[model samples]
Target: MACVYSMRSSLFWMMLVSLTGLAITGCATSVSTTTDKPRLAQQSVLSTLWMDRAGEYRALCHQAFNMAKLQVDRRLSYHRTLEKPLAVIVDIDETVLSNVPYFSQLIDKGEVFPRGWKVWMQMSTAQAIPGALEFLKYARFRGVEVFYISNRSINEGLTATINNLVKMDFPFADQRHLLLKSKSGNKQPRRDRVEQTHEVILLIGDNLNDFSLIFSDKPVVQRNNAVDMMSSEFGKRFIILPNPIYGDWEGALYDYQWGTSSAQKLKVRQQLYNQ
Candidate 1:
């Protein structure tokens, strides 16, 4: 009887050892698999705050639509006797669509602008901005035309942009209404074309360049002065949207030079902050 009990204890010990060995082997495999795997970092506090406050964002959209409606009404009233079609020029990204997801993807990857920006634009998955769809529909109902004046370089993605707009049910006419950046990155030619057929009553965008090509290449101080000059036009014939993600503001601060190395750019940015 004693011998039988000893044999059972030995078998139990053997099984315990085997299980422990398996567990260690499995853990080592897992560690090896995850050692060099990529992972996204956490978003910044500002981004988190903005994303968390859905109610505020909705209110902002409402305000934007109200402002747009007022401009549209004013334009229609002014062009009541004009033989030409009444139209409004609107910027696509940030002003008419939300590309937060694309930016968030970049943030997750611990990346910054330029490369990420190119990739985001290439994806062309930007959805309509909050209240933009409603405002466009309202304008359409009022017999006003909407033109998308984007700085997105003309390329294979142009078709994708149009298709995405259609999918989102935005009021888009064909290639005629979509103005892309020319080789010069100047928007005046496109604006000229729009003016030929339609009297532009209001211009809406998150950037000053959307309204006119004047400030497109201006320095920071000059740009501010230009904005001051046009301050009176804002909220009347111009509706500016809020965009904190990226803009010409960054360009001006960085000397409008894109060919500089990343380290040099970082140094310049740091110097600006120190000043």
Candidate 2:
């Protein structure tokens, strides 16, 4: 479904307009201007997916998975992974299951997140990314253990997340394979947990933090530097699904402060874009 420009109410925009000269508030803001949508910080996120790029998005998924398949082949050819059960660590949202519906609802219905989020998950209708299921199943068929590590908290929507996964016919779709965030957002701990049993051949997600702590909780520039340092590993050991909507990339622009108002954040982003 197409998104219906779901930003906050008009009064909020007026208040933000009034704050044009106000310094950054107690709540941090992002340089990425998606806060209130002069279109989502990255307009391409919605426009590309909701418009002409639907096929391109699917093609990217297929290509990423294809690259992953080749990597798996390379690993199989190498004897190092044979010593332990092989596995791939993946993030749940956006990477495997597309959550564009919730995003669309926000734009169309003007309903904010954590409001209709649970209801959306409860519906259990998140379609799998174009090539995710096939690649995951292929990994399973080759005896690779798949671990789904997501920041979707247990207290928030874990049950429905699991149900959605199982409903979508994802392999290893059970409590054993599904992991919801409990302790921290740092997925390295969960990756370590998986590595305790199997060699994690690949770490997949739409966010940079999904792969390593280097990108976790860091500033925007630092995260980019870390990505540059590990450039060689991206396609080979870390498969990143495209998610221009929201992630650490956007969060970093706000300096990781969660309390920033949409209006304030948008102002900050606008400044960045103008620069």
Whole-model lDDT per candidate: 0.75, 0.79
For model 1, give the RMSD to the true fold.
Answer: 13.6
Candidate 1 lDDT by residue in tens digits, 1-275: 99999999999999999999999976544332221212212323365347435677667767877898987887676565548888888888888878778767655665555446666666657777788999999999999899998888767457777877887899964687898776766777888889999988888888888888778878899999999998898888878877766678767876788554444455566678798
Summarize candidate 2's per-residue lDDT along 25-116 as a digit string, tens digits: 43454443334543442443454355224787778888999999888888888756449889998898888998886776666644345567
Considering summed lDDT, which 10 consecutive residues are worst modelled in model 1? 32-41
Q: Highest TM-score among the candidates is held by which one?
A: 2
Model 2 stretches astray by more than 4 angstroms: 1-53, 80-82
